[model samples]
Structures are given as structure tokens and as C-alpha cells.
Target: MAQSRTTEHCVQMPAHGAGQGKTAAPTPEKQLNCFVRCIALIERLGNALGTLAFTWATVVLLGGYPTALSSKDFRYATAIVSLEAARMFSRNNRLDYQLLFRTRGAVRPLGWNGLTVIVPAAIIRIVLASLRLGSHSYYGDDGHLDKRNPGDKTNLVPSLNIFYGMVLGQGALYIAACMLDIFSFIPQRSLARQGGYADDDRLLRKISGQALTMLAMDSVNNCLTMLRETGYVFIKELTSIIRVDRYRCVAASLLRSMCLHAQQELEESDQRELSYALREVLERTLIADGAELEIFIGLSSQICKVIPEDLAKELEDSHIKQRFVMRLVDVLNSYTEPSPHCPGIRRVILEQAINMMEHDSRYTNCFIDRHMAEALSMVEETVSEAENYSLFLGDVGLMEAREPLSSLMARAKQLLAVR
Candidate 1:
């Protein structure tokens, strides 16, 4: 009877499987992680392969050629290739802009960067030919040779022409690949036409400031990599300057956008949204404290410049509006230190202040004057006999004195007095 009862007992299992009614997958986050990993992998591989190729080419050609290939030359080539690959991969492969365009039957190309390279290369080639840089130099039967041969020199002109042609040829191909990328940005016909040609400045507007800022950082890092490969101090500095400028431009633009958003919110009588936007702008400006303040301040100044004087007056008249200015001053203090003509971080802060001052006579005459005076005082204290210039970008530490760093405090007070 017990055996009969046991035989009737059933063991059940779900048909679907474990986690059949599982939680939703983190599809977006997972994809983002994968994308980032893929990019990093590609970049690493490109850098390694590019350096190796350049090194190998230089070594092999040094013995066989009259003029050895310089590290700078090889590095430049590698940088061009690496950046080109990255731009292409980002635009077409990863983003799937091509596929999206096909659905709509709208496609376009970007040719600006090619023009950028070609123009520079063309000019350099012209200068080289005029100066006869590689003339009278050759690799002959035995070894390297330098001789004045009129006929050879005449023939060499064609060779030089060919060299320039090669440079342009490479530039052209690179441009073609870049043009393929244009489709990604040009989704609608109106958007594409409004965006203008590849070389047009309007293209900058299509990219968000945050996106541009990220790109700027990447570009800087790439430039550093280039510097290590090339070992040319001048080029490295040039790249650094460009990177810095790019950051400033993006930051400033972002600030302007934020201000516009805030203005729109105010116009719509959406106080909650206005407050949210203002808070966001303030947070961002403060976050940029570690960097130069030019972008942040420049953005503020730009906003002030464009808004009607009556609105500006209304804003200044209100406590809420004054809070915005105070927020700016606080950010400026956190972002910069005092210096003549405001180099580095100071330059950005001061430039923005000056720009804002230029727009309103009252701000120029009163508000900025007071703030400058206060800032000067802070600077004086910061640069007393002890000369606490050790720390920069405004990360002041605690004082051991019970009286609380009188000298530093006095400098700050003095700055206020001056203003």
C-alpha cells in the first residue's frame, strides 16, 4: 500500500526553466560597458601597432635613404591614422548612422578635416620647395650623397611634386572616410542643410557641449600620446594649447545653453524648472573649479550680453537674481587665484568678468568692482610673508594659528577695501 501511494506521488518541474520569470535585463548599461571596453581595446591596439610600424619603418629606411625618417614624421603619420580610425569607428560602426540613413534615404559626407590637412600640407610643401630643403641630397650606389647637379635638381622638382601629391592623396582618402561620417549627424534633410558643409562652423552646434568636452579631453590625451611618439616639444605644446582652447570653447558654450534654458524657464513662468536649471549650471561651474574658469564665466557673460537690458535689470533687482551673481562669485573664488593679466585659471575667470562688465554699466561700475576688491584681499592673504603659493587652483588648507591666519584674512579684507 505504501509502495502504491509512493508510485502516485509526482515530482514537478517548471517547463520554461530557472529565472523564466526573471527581472528585466540591464540592457542599456550593459551595452554602454561593452561599447567602452571595445573602444579602449581598439585604441590600445592602434597605439601599439602604430608605434611599432613607425619605429620599424624608420629603422629600415634610415640605412637605405639619404635623409633618415625623423621620429616626428613617423609620429605624425601614426597620429593621423589613429585619430582617423577612431573618428570613423565612432561615427559609422558604433553609432550605426549608415543603417539609419539608409532607412530615410538621406546621406552626406564631411570633408572639412581633409581640407584642414591638405591646406597645411600644401603650404608646407610649397615652403620646402622654395627653400630647397632636400635638394642636393640623395642615396646613391655606395651611400648617401650631396651634390649640385642642375639636371638632377630639375628632375628632382618632379619628385618633390610627387611627394606633395602623395601627401594630398593621403589627405584626400582620409577626407573621404571622414565624409562617410557626416551621414551620422545629418539625419533629416532640414537638419543636414541647416548644418551646412563639412567645413562650416555650424557643425559645432550639432554636437552637444558635453560631447565636445569629452572629445576635447580625448583629443588632448591623443596629443600627449603623439608627443611621446614624436619627441617634438613644439608640437606637443601646440597640441596642448589646442586642447585647452577646445575645453574652454565647449565649457563656455555649455554655460550659454544652460543660461538660455533658465531664461526660457523664466519666460514660461516655470519657477521650479528655472531653479533646477540654475542649480545645475551652478553645480557645473563649481565642478570646473579644478580647471580654468574661462568657460564658465565666459558663458555667464555671454548670457548677460544677449538678454535685454530691462530683463537684466529685473534680474539684478531681485534677490533670486542676485543669488545667481553670488553663485558665480563663489565659483570664481573656488576656481582661480590672483595674478596680473590672469594667466591660467585666473585668465579665464577675469576674462569672463570683464566680458560681463562690458555689457552693463552698473555691473562694471559697482558689482564687479566690489568682487574684485574682495578677491584681491583673498589673494594678498594667500601670498603673505609665508607665501602660501604652494597650493594652486584654490585648495587652501587649515591654519595652525588660533587667531586664524591673520595675514591671509587681512589680504582678503584688503582686496575688499580696494574694490
Candidate 2:
């Protein structure tokens, strides 16, 4: 897995719609979890600060700002912009982090997501309150100490009180104290009352333009990770992938995994979307130049052989399986020679193709037209006295044929010839 260094620290979102009631008090585990949330919030804050600093310094030194904008205006603009950008980036790229920490361990207890949000929110409000209190310092108590904008509001920062910030973060305590104080009196309320309690959430990253552009690029690097988890994303890198010898089996294993998954959900209608996705995987790997990706000249052939009958029944009944059969037939038709060291790759595909055609008239015609007579006869002629191919994960080789590949091929040929 080509994981980023930050991947290890990736936190997962909480489960959706958890009916479990919130625990009354933080347990030892919960407290430790609280610490973790705090750390994550701190990490996020540090990144934001760095972005703000870089944004401010670059504009000030490199003269990126317009002549009308004061230094302070540019700094505040960057601050506001950076915060919004960071939050948006974090929200959008959550899927990437989720893909990395994909195991069950990624899911924290219910309400942890609430912590992710609440922790950052709580800290920011507290820091704001503290800054607001200090903004009125006598030594620096200029009229513009709070604001001089056309609509600058007073009580912009409440007193440095945790309870006030914890509850009324966006609201000020004494609006009459400042110019826009009247509107600050418009109070807001919500269900949460406990100090640090937070609940249901799902989202998960950052850096800027030029520099921001670089940061954005850095955060959007889930493509490589997706190739590990999703189908077909890695084919773009197939040239590099095939060079690594062990990756051959790894690629084959993906096909096997997709096959078993389709079989498990063969009867479910809702799975049509997923079935089609798997079908593409089979086609790209099996029907189209599947020979080059072979681990042992017949790796795809093994998966093709193990393809079950439920896949071959009816297109309406199982689209994915039907597609599986269709691709396997193409594979059989494309066969040049059977695996010299192993017999099952071509042999199993040939056998299953015959079985499916006999069982389903829909497929029989397709097979007879596509690969039934020509390909079957070609492989059948190469059938040996020893061609027992049991498709197992362990010992991936053609098993000793107690009854001979030629005999099995004879029966398959007879079944097709009669049809």
C-alpha cells in the first residue's frame, strides 16, 4: 500500500445512526479518546496557523495584495480564507483517509465524530475568547481596538470564560458593550448541554494556492490508495505492476476475490451495480490480454475455471455471472496453448464453458457461435492423460489426473458435438 506518512494518524468517522445512548461520564478509555481528539485538533490548528502565516507573509513580502488593502486587511483576509479552505478540504478529502484506515479499527465508538468537531470548535472559541479579552487591553485600548469597519460589531469576543464559549460560541455575552452589540443579543440554542459532549459525524485534510496548490495536490493523493481498494484504477500502472514478480499473484488474487464476491451475491438484485463493476474486472483481466498478467501462464485461467454455474444461469437472473461466462468464453477462444506445466487453466475453462452451455440455452448459442466448436476442439486435442486441476489457493498447479484430461475432454466434446 503506497500510504502517505500521515495515513497512520488518520482517524475514522463514527458509525452512522448508532442507537446507543451516550455514556454518562467519560470512562478511562473515553478520557484517553478525548486526549486523542485534542491531539487531532491541535494538529489541525497548527496546520491552519502555518497556512495563515505563509499566506500572510507571501502576500506582504511578494506584494500579492492590491494597493487599497492594508497589511492588517490582507492578514485577516488570509486568516478567514485559510480557515474556510482548510475546513472544506478536510470535509472533501475524508474519503481518502477513510480508504486508508479501512479496517474495522478505523471506526471509533459512537459520538467520537462529535468529538472531532466539538473539540476543534471548543478550542477555537476558547482561544477566541482569550484573544477577545486581551484585545481590550488598556495599553493598546485604541477606539479601533475592537473594530472600525462600517459594520464592526462590539462584544466580538466574550469574556475569557469556558462555559460561555462552550455553549454560546458564535454569540457574545454583552452585546451593548460594542457597536454591533444589538444583533449579538439574538440568541441561539441547541440540544447539547454537557461541556465536551459531541456526537454523530462523518468527514475527514490541507496546504494552499501556488503553495496552496501544492497543499491541495498533497491532500488529494487518494488515487493510489483507491487502486488498492477499488477495481480498475490500477490498470493505468499495469506496466510497472507486471514487472514486480509477486504482484502477479496479487493481481490474480483480486480476480479470485471479485469472482467469489459475485457468487455470494448472485441472487441479489440490488447487487447489479456491483456485479457490473466486477464484470469489467473480469473482462479487462481475462478476455483482454489476460495472458501478460499471468503469474504462472494460467493464473487467470485458474480463476476462469473456478467460475461457478450460478454465474452462467440467466442474464436476467445474474448479469454479473452471465458476463463472467461471456468473458470466460472469450478467454477460451483466445487460448493459444494449454499451460505446459499445469493442465487446469485451459482445461477447467473448457469444461465449465461446456457445462454452462448445456445448462443454459441462452449461453449455448453464444458459445457455439463464439468459441464452442473451434476453441474446445483445439484444447481438447491437447488434453493429456494427466490433467486433474483442482483450483485451490494452496499448491496452485495441475493435479495428477487419475482419470486423464483426455477422457474428461472426450465427455465435454461429446456434449458439445451432440448439441
TM-score for each model: 0.33, 0.29
Model 1 misplaced regions, further than 4 Å: 1-296, 308-311, 317-322, 336-345, 368-371, 374-419
Q: List the residue pairs that clash in candidate 1.
A: 110-179, 342-347, 373-415, 373-416, 377-411, 377-412, 377-415, 378-412, 381-408, 381-411
- Clash pairs (backbone) in predicted model 2: 90-205, 114-199, 208-211, 208-212, 208-213, 209-212, 209-213
Native-to-model Cα distance after best TM-score fit, residue 404 in candidate 1, in Å: 35
Cα misplacement distance, residue 238 of candidate 2 (Å): 18
1-419: candidate 1 lDDT, tens digit per residue: 00101100011111222245688443322332233223333333433433343343334332332243334333433444344354344432221111111111111222454346434533443343333333423223323424564433233334433433343344443333334334334332323343233432333332322232222232333322222322323222222222343333443443343343333322322233233233333335555543334344444454444453533554555434555556556654663433321223333344345545555545544545447656644544443322222111123321122222344344334333433
Candidate 1: give its CA RMSD in angstroms: 20.1
- What lDDT does each candidate get? 0.35, 0.36
TM-score of 1: 0.33
- On TM-score, the leading prediction is 1
lDDT of 2 by residue, 77-196 (tens): 354445435543655433222311221212222134533543464355345445534444311224444345523223322211222232233212111112111121121001111222
TM-score for candidate 2, residues paired by index: 0.29
lDDT of model 1, residue 274: 30
